[model samples]
Target: MAETHFGEWIAAHYATLWPELFDPALIGATVGFLAGLAPGGGSALEFGVGTGRIAIPLQDQGLEVYGMELSPAMAAHLDGTGVEVLVGDYATAHMTRTFDIVYLLRNTITNLVTQDEQVRAFENAAAHLRPGGCFVVENYIPRLRDRVFAETPEHLGVEEYDLATQIAVSRHRWIIDGEQREFSSPHRYVWPAELDLMARIAGLRLRERWSDWHRAPFTAASTDHVSVWAKPFSHSRAVPNS
Candidate 1:
């Protein structure tokens, strides 16, 4: 089984821990981009929809939004938000119905921590997408050249990567009220080409890839990416060109 990094403590202080993600401008931009794809009464499914941060606003934009979450504590934040919540692992969960779009945001894909699980996540997303539908993902580019470090008066964070295993361990320690608190999570960092292969294996084709939500060009210097893959209209085996 995969480990769930987000739990009661993380849920309770989610906003506090990641305040930058709550910015209205960023949220608006993200919703605008997604809403553009699902025009004309289309429906959306958010994988790892934590705290209804984007789902709520997207729903308010007249889109039918559903969520698949692994943590009940995090899903609890969506109470009465009108966004249907399915408490289960997004990588392995099965839904009876399909949607116009399925998305994973904020580098949440890395949480799977294993290549097989990540591939399964893509397959599951494809399974939930309607014909010609899209599976979108927003994730950070792996920065193996330089290590990650976060330092503050109240907190310290360090991320170490193992090239052989492609495992990145994020370790953190926080001092709140003069008491010590610590947490760590493991992630399997994947390259863009690898993700593309996974999408192909899932019977989806790459539609677009950008450096950010603004549709900026993806270049070698880019540190993050938002990629979209579309399911073909028919699942029948493709015939070779004559």
Candidate 2:
């Protein structure tokens, strides 16, 4: 089956499940501001911009935002928003425009399911960046493995509520595949070290790594990953303006 299933599932239930589960407004605005803080007004690109969840707010932040997504259903939802949404895979997708910032949010990077593909995704992101441009990625840390193996449930109590639907959704993470890895859901997990190595291979330099959008210090119990990388100006010739 195409990876489109995941996008379709989210699009079908976005209005119902999204707001109740997470604060989309807060997330989108926060990421946008963070990205905008980069040089050059944060002219940005996003890989896997599912349903414009973050892209829309990024635009509201006055940054020129472009996106590449793997799902047609999700792309269609972005119609008329004036946001550039291209339907394609991030690993092999190519764009002529290099931006000051490129981002992969919502743990979308882990969907690649393999190390080689994940590394390729980083390479692709690097290819689309201007010299001195930044690439940001946000994901949950791998602590889910320990939490799942422990007898106690790492309770992710409800963060919000929907009075109309009454479908209370709680979030949690767990370990699977022999405790070598953990996942927030069914996809594979990647460690921060692994991502750093991938960035190095892509000719990008690590700028910062944080536990949250607010730049919290990463810890054993931290449940999120936020990493930033920069491409040197010498690599500017590697990309073309689209």
lDDT (Cα, tens digit) per residue for candidate 1, span 92-113: 9888999999999998999998
Those runs of model 2 whose alpha carbons end farther than 4 Å from true positions after fitting are 20-25, 144-186, 235-242
Q: What local lDDT score does residue 134 receive in model 2, on the 0 to 100 scale?
A: 86
Question: What pairs collide in candidate 1?
Answer: none
Where does model 1 exceed 4 Å of error?
A: 149-155, 175-180, 237-242
Q: Which residue pairs in candidate 2 have backbone atoms (N, alpha carbon, C) closer than 3 angstroms, thus clashing? A: none
Candidate 1, which ten residues in sequence have the lowest lDDT sum?
Answer: 233-242
Separately for all candidates shown, the number of backbone clashes (residues 3 or more apart, or on different chains) is 0, 0
Q: Score every model by TM-score.
A: 0.93, 0.76
Query: Model 1, 47: alpha-carbon shift in Å?
Result: 0.7
Q: Write the per-residue lDDT of candidate 2 for residues 28-127, one digit (tens) a residue.
A: 5566546555644567888988777777777777788889988887788889897898789988889878888889987788677667788899999988
**Most TM-score-accurate candidate:** 1
TM-score of 1: 0.93
Q: Residue 133 in candidate 2 has what lDDT?
A: 82
